[model samples]
Target chain A: MADHLSEPFKKSAMTNEEIMKTQREMRIQFIAFAFMIALTFLAFIAVGAEVAPPGFVISFIIFLAFIQLFLQLYYFMHLKDKDHGWANTFMVSGLVLSIPTIVALILIIGVVKY
Target chain B: MSETVDVSRGLPAHPERATLEGKNKFVGFWVFLSGEVTMFATFFGTYLGLRNGTAGGPEAADLFHMPLVFIMTMILLTSSLTSVIAITAMKKNQFKKMKLWMWITFFLGVAFLGFEIYEFVEYVHYGLGFSTSAFASSFYSLVGLHGAHVVFGLGWVLLLLIRYNRAGITLTNAPKFYMFSLYWHFIDVVWVFIFTVVYLMGIGGG
Candidate 1:
C-alpha cells in the first residue's frame, strides 16, 4: 500500500522536512476548516435562537465574519507565507482605500429612509 | 533560455513563486485583486446604503431567508478547502489528485450558483424585482456581480484542467494553477462578507 501511494509523489523531490511541513499544514487546514464550520453554526444560533440582543447579534456575526475572512486569506490563499510581501502590500492598500469609500457611501445613502 | 527547465524531480518549495515568470504573475494578480477589492467595496457600500430603500416594496428583512444563504455559504467555503487541497496535491506533483480536487471545487461552485439562482427567482416571485426599488437594484448589483465571478472562475478552472490534461505538471502550468486557486480563495472571501453584511444583517442577525 505504501509503495503504491508513494508513486504519485515520486516525480517530486520529497525531502523529509518538506513532508513534515506538509503534514503540519494539513493538520492546520483541518483545524481551520472545523473552526469555520463551528463559527457558521454559532452565527446561525445567534440569530435563530435569539440568545443575544438584536444589536449584539449583528456585531457578533460581523466579528465572526472577520475571523473567517482572515483564515480564508491567510491560510487558504497562502497570503501569510514569507514570500508574499508584495501580495500583502497590495491587499493592505486595497483594504485601506476601500474603507473611506465605504464610509462615504454609507453617509451619502443616509439610513433615515429605511 | 538562461535556465533549463527541470522536468524530472518535483517543484521548489514555492513552485508558483519560484521563477521570475511565476513571481511576476503572482504579484500582478494580487494587484488586480486589490483593484477588485475597491470595486466590490463600492457595490457593498451601495447595497448597504440602499438595502432599506425598498420604495415600499419588499425589504431585505422580508426578502432574505437565512437557511438558504447558510447552505450556500457552506458550499462555497467547502470549495475553498477543495482548492487548497488541489494546490497541496500540486506541491507534491500529484497531478491526478490535483485535477480531481479542482473538479470537486468546480462542481461545488456550480452547486452554489444553482442555489443563488433559485434564491433570486424566489425573491423576484416575492415582488422584489431588480427595478422594483433602489434596494433591489443594489442587491442585484452586489450579489449578481459575485455570481458572475463564480461563473467566470468555473470556466477558468475548466480550461486549465483541459489544457493541462495531457501536458503533465510543467513550470508553465504550475503558476497558472496556483493563480487560479488564489482567485478561488478571493471569491470565498467575498462570500464571507456577503454572508455577514448582506445575509446575516438582512435577517436581523447581523
Candidate 2:
C-alpha cells in the first residue's frame, strides 16, 4: 500500500474528456486572473490620478478590493466548487464576525478617547 | 491511510483529495484559514483606529510611496497566478510542469519579500520605527504580521519542494502542494486589502 502511494504512475488517469474539462477550467481561471489584475490596476490608478474626492476614492478602492477578494477566494481557491460547502460556511462566518469586530474597534479605539 | 489510496490504475483525477487523510487536511486547513481571517481583522481594526496617532512622526501621506507599493502588489499578484497554474498542472498529473510553475511561484514570492524588507528598511530610515508612535507600532504590527506570514509560507513551500524534489506527485504530497497554493492565494487576498487600506488610503489623503 505504501509503495503504491509513493510510486509515480506511468500515465495519468484522466480521460480525454476529463482532460478537456480541466483545460476549460484552466482557461476560466486565466480569465479570472486577468480580471483581478485589471481590478488592481484600476484601484491604483483611481488613487494615483486623484480624479475623485478622498472619501470617494477610498471607498472606490475598497470596493475594488472586495471584488478582488471574491475573485481570489472563489476562482483561485476553488471555494466556489460544489464540494466546498464547509469551506464556504467557515469563510462566510469569519467575514460576518469580522465586520462587527472591525467596526467596534474603530469606534471604541478611534472615537472614544481612552 | 495509504490503504485508501489505490494508485494502481494511474494517478487519480483529484490526487490531492484521493485519500481520507487528504480530505481531512483539506477541511482542516480551511478551518485554520477562517481563524486567520479574524486574527488579521483585529490588527486591521487597530491600525484603522490609530492610524491618525502619528505623534509628530512621518505620517502615512509623507512616508508611503505609491510606486513601490504598486510594484510589490504586482509581484505578489503574479505569484498567486503562478501557484494557480501549478495546481492546475498538478490536477492534470503534469509533475514537471507543476514543479516548474511552483518554482516560479517561489521565486516570485521571494521577490515580493525582498520588496517588503526594502520597504520596511526605508520606513525605519525615515524614522518610523516600531516604537516611534502609536501609528508606527500598529502599522508595523499589522503589516509586519502579514510579512511574517509570507516568510513562514515561503519557508513551508521551500521545505515541501525540497523534501518532495524527487518524489513525483504522490497522494501524500499532492495535498501538501494544494494547501500551499491555497495559502499563497490567501496571502494575495490579504495584500489586496493591505494595498487598499494601508498604502492607497495613506497616499490618497484618507
Say which candidate scores most in DockQ: 2
Give the alpha carbon lDDT tens digit for every residue of A30-66 in model 1.
7888888899988878887876788989988889988
Best lDDT among the predictions, by candidate number: 2
Candidate 2's C-alpha lDDT?
0.91
Name model 2 segments beyond 4 Å from true. A1-3, B1-6
Best by TM-score: 2
lDDT of each: 0.85, 0.91
TM-score for chain A, candidates 1 onward in order: 0.84, 0.92
- Candidate 2 per-residue lDDT over residues B1-206, each given as its tens digit: 35465577789889888888889999999999999999999999999999998999999999999989989998999999999999988988888999999999999999999999999999999999999988999999999999999999999999999999988898889999999999999999999999999999999998
DockQ of each: 0.40, 0.75
Cα RMSD over interface residues, candidate 1: 5.5
- Fnat per candidate, as a fraction, reads 0.59, 0.75
Runs in model 1 lying further than 4 Å from the true structure: A1-10, A112-114, B1-8
- Pairs of residues at least 3 apart in sequence or in different chains that clash in candidate 2: none
For candidate 1, what is the lDDT? 0.85
